[model samples]
Target: MVALAKKKEWSLLLLLAPALLYFLIYHFIPISGMVMAFQDYRIFGKSPFVGFKHFRILFASPAFLQVLRNTLIISFMKIVLFFPLPIIFALMLNEVRSSILRKFIQSTTYLPHFLSWVVIAGIWIAFLSPANGGLNQLREMFKLAPKDYMTDKGAIRWVLFASETWRSLGWDSIIYLAALASISPSLYESADLD
Candidate 1:
């Protein structure tokens, strides 16, 4: 069998040709482009090798350091601060007995997940617009100062965090929702009886 396989059987390989071609085209082709990372990749001409130069420059750049810091801050805010929110939302959803209201809430929340990031960004911009945003209007209603969140350094990170959370909220809760659905109703009954 091993000798026959090594002899290149046309039948089995023909059956796998499409999958092999897909791997060659999509996977290996792009990965082989990693050679460009070591070269000054020119579109029309031969790329000259520049080993570790780009990496060194990237690491040394002050702008890169600040970007890294901001990324860490945003990640912490999104992951640590936002982690419990979906679970809490799912728990609240589980407690609600009204099927109509529950479905309504689910639909609204799930709809955001279907929207593109550009649309979400536009909505956030409208919300934070200085002159006539909902937030500014609310502030004015309370006789407080209207701050432009878009221009405010202190508020931009929060805006980013909020937008990310809003985008993922319903989608993330889906797993918990599935888990909640699978829980035996008798468990709740037993707890109530105790």
Candidate 2:
């Protein structure tokens, strides 16, 4: 059986060559560079190993701790709060009867996902600008003072959440839409009958 398998697998090995090459070049080669994390990296001479030195510094630093805390809090909000939102959005969208409107909505929402962060930043900067910006203009109408949220630390976290949602909602919904599509329509029919 082993001999027969090896003989039959020769063509399969050839078929896998591109993927094997990609793994070696893209993944394994770059992963090998991670050894520098344990070393004091040097360009000309050999890097000297200083195990746990960087990690100790990272842990001891107040700024690093603050960054770490912010990262964890932001990650939790994005992952826990926002994760289920796309699935719900897709489900709600699936319920819509008008294909034209549905397509329009999907396209509009998905477009922001394709935009780069720099472009998004430019757009948001303009939107949130205190002087002659959209948000401030609206605020002025309501007799409220203009506020620049870009540099405000309190506003920064909410901005992250909002931008993350804006960027990912449509793209993330696609997977859930696919899952929804895979559900057999007969199951719904059966449920209706019951």
Candidate 3:
């Protein structure tokens, strides 16, 4: 029994070796480079430490403050507005009796999560373009003036939120779906009887 346990331990360690090596090389080693943030970096010599000079300059700038405000707003919108959506989606999907239809919906939604951000950004730009974009075309149909959503400051954050929701919805709902699936049918049967 001890011999078998020792073999299993070695097997687990062998499986983990590549991931441990990868983090050591890529993540841990690169963290040391963050010291450059405190230094006036020079290409060929030992750089003098500037401490908080860069951070002071950044915090003093109005543009930096504006960017920081935008970041906070966007993050809040993403967290608050997007949190319930996946749970709702999972509930809806759990009610879907047809396996084919559920799978089709899952595949369609999951595809966006796998897409690179650059590709997603390009797709969104094309779809939101003022000239002959899908959205502008719909607006033109309704006799409304074309709105440049990509360039609009007020609409940009909502756009980011919508895009993030679209990319993450199905992938995020998978966890909730698994949880739902784990509930025994006997629980529902007993509830129905009650």
Candidate 4:
């Protein structure tokens, strides 16, 4: 058995070489640059070690604190408020009897997920534009003033949440739909009988 394993060792190593090389190039090599976080990075000459000096300055800054607060709020909105949407969407989709309508809704929602963030951002910016934007046009029809959502500090977080939901809702609901599909028909039949 040892002789046979030794004979195939070169073949086994050849098969593993691509993955090893990929990790070395992409992951392990890039990790070495993390040392720069503790150093006062200089374009020329050796960089001096600064330890936690940068972190101290960052934490002390009012702007950083505000940014951190905004990040936390956005994260909470995305994680907590957005959590149940996909599940609810999936449940509603599962109950849809018309295959055509279901397919259309799924396709329309899932299309946004395939778009890159840059493209999605552009789409949102255009849609939310205070001048001649679809949303603003609708607002005008209701005798309301056009609001610049992108520049408004108070509205920007909600814009981010809305964009994230639009981008993720359909794709995220797929897992829930799959779970729903996996339930045995007999279980539903038994529940119906009850």
Candidate 5:
């Protein structure tokens, strides 16, 4: 048992060595570089210690503050506001009984999620064009004046949110579906018995 344990420990070390070395070299070494943030970094010789100067500069800059605020707002919109929409979409999709229609909808919707950002930007430009675009065309049919939403600051945020929802609505719903499928059959069976 002692010899077997020794063999297993050696085997585990051999298996882990490459990954351990990579982490130490890539992650730990790079992280250690952050200490330079507090020091006056130079190519040669010992870096002069200048504690909190860079941090003070970072906090005092208005541009940095605006950037920080924008980061917070965008993160909140994407992470918090957008999170529940996919679950609702999945629940709605799961209720539809027609397999062909379900598959068609899923495929068409999922296709957008897989598109590159450049392709998606092109699609959005076409969709939101003021002249003869799909959305404007629909608006004109309803006797509404064509409005360019892409360039409007008031509309751009909602445009971003809507586009994000459109792309992710199908893909993220897949998780909800897996969760739904994981539900025990006995619950339905019991309800039917009652």
Candidate 6:
């Protein structure tokens, strides 16, 4: 019985080995790279040890501080201000009686989140490019000069927020949709009768 059980255990281990190795290579190995931020990273053998020098430089720089502030502002815009959007969308979507329109909205909202971040970024870059993007076309319509949002310091934050919203809207709205589905039809009926 023990001899037969040995191969069964080994077979299970063999099946799991690839996933375990993948996790170690991708997740655990990258953690060791955290030290590279402190030290001067080298392609050759020995990297010169510099403790907290990089961090000191990062903390002391005004540009870094400004970037940090921008990041927080973007996060707040993404999380707090953006939180209501899914609820609003779900409510609006609930009111959509035409099944075709509802499916179209759902697909448009959900599809972007499934796209690779690089692809999404490229699409956004092209859309916002000053040369002849959709946005530039709109700007031209309004007789306003086309601005390069990718390069513009002031405009980039809003671009980030917008891109994040596009990516998050579908997935976040799913929770509300699920809640809406679980709700009793009698409740809606009673509300309507009121």
- The lDDT leader among the candidates is 4
Indicate the residue-level lDDT of 11 in model 6: 97
Specify the poorest-scoring 10-residue window by lDDT in model 2: 121-130
Model 1: which residue pairs collide?
none
Candidate 2 residues 68-114, lDDT tens each? 88899899989999999999999998998899998988888889999
Model 4 lDDT tens row, 1-194: 99899879978999999999999999999999998989999999999999998889988998997898999999999999999999999999999989999999989998999999999999999999999889999999999999999999999999999999999999999999999999999999999999
Tell how far residue 57 is off in model 6, in angstroms. 1.7
lDDT for each residue of candidate 6 in 1-194, tens digit (9 for 90 to 100): 99899999999999999999999999999999888987898999999999999999988998997889888988888889899999999988888999899989988998888988999899999999899999999999999999999999889988998998899898888889878879999999999999
Give model 6's clash tally: 0
Comparing candidate 1 with candidate 3, which one achieves the higher TM-score?
3
TM-scores for every predicted model? 0.82, 0.85, 0.87, 0.87, 0.72, 0.79
Provide backbone clash counts, one per model.
0, 0, 0, 0, 0, 0
Model 1, global lDDT:
0.92
**Candidate 3 structure quality by residue, lDDT tens digits, 106-154:** 8898889999999999999999999989999999999999999999999
Candidate 4: segments with Cα more than 4 A from true spot: 7-22, 40-53
The C-alpha lDDT values of all candidates are 0.92, 0.91, 0.95, 0.96, 0.88, 0.91
Model 4: colliding residue pairs = none
Per-residue lDDT of model 1, residues 12-118, tens digit only: 78889999999999999999889899999999989999999999999999899889988999999998999999999999998889999999998888789999999
- Choose 4 or 6, whichever is better by lDDT: 4
Candidate 5 clash figure, as a count: 0
For model 5 the local lDDT of residue 31 reads 99
For candidate 5, the lDDT comes to 0.88
- Cα lDDT tens digits, model 5, 1-194, are 99999999999999999999999999999998899999999999999999999999998997897779767877789999999988887888778899899888878877888988788888888999999789999999999999999988678777887888888888998889779778898997999999
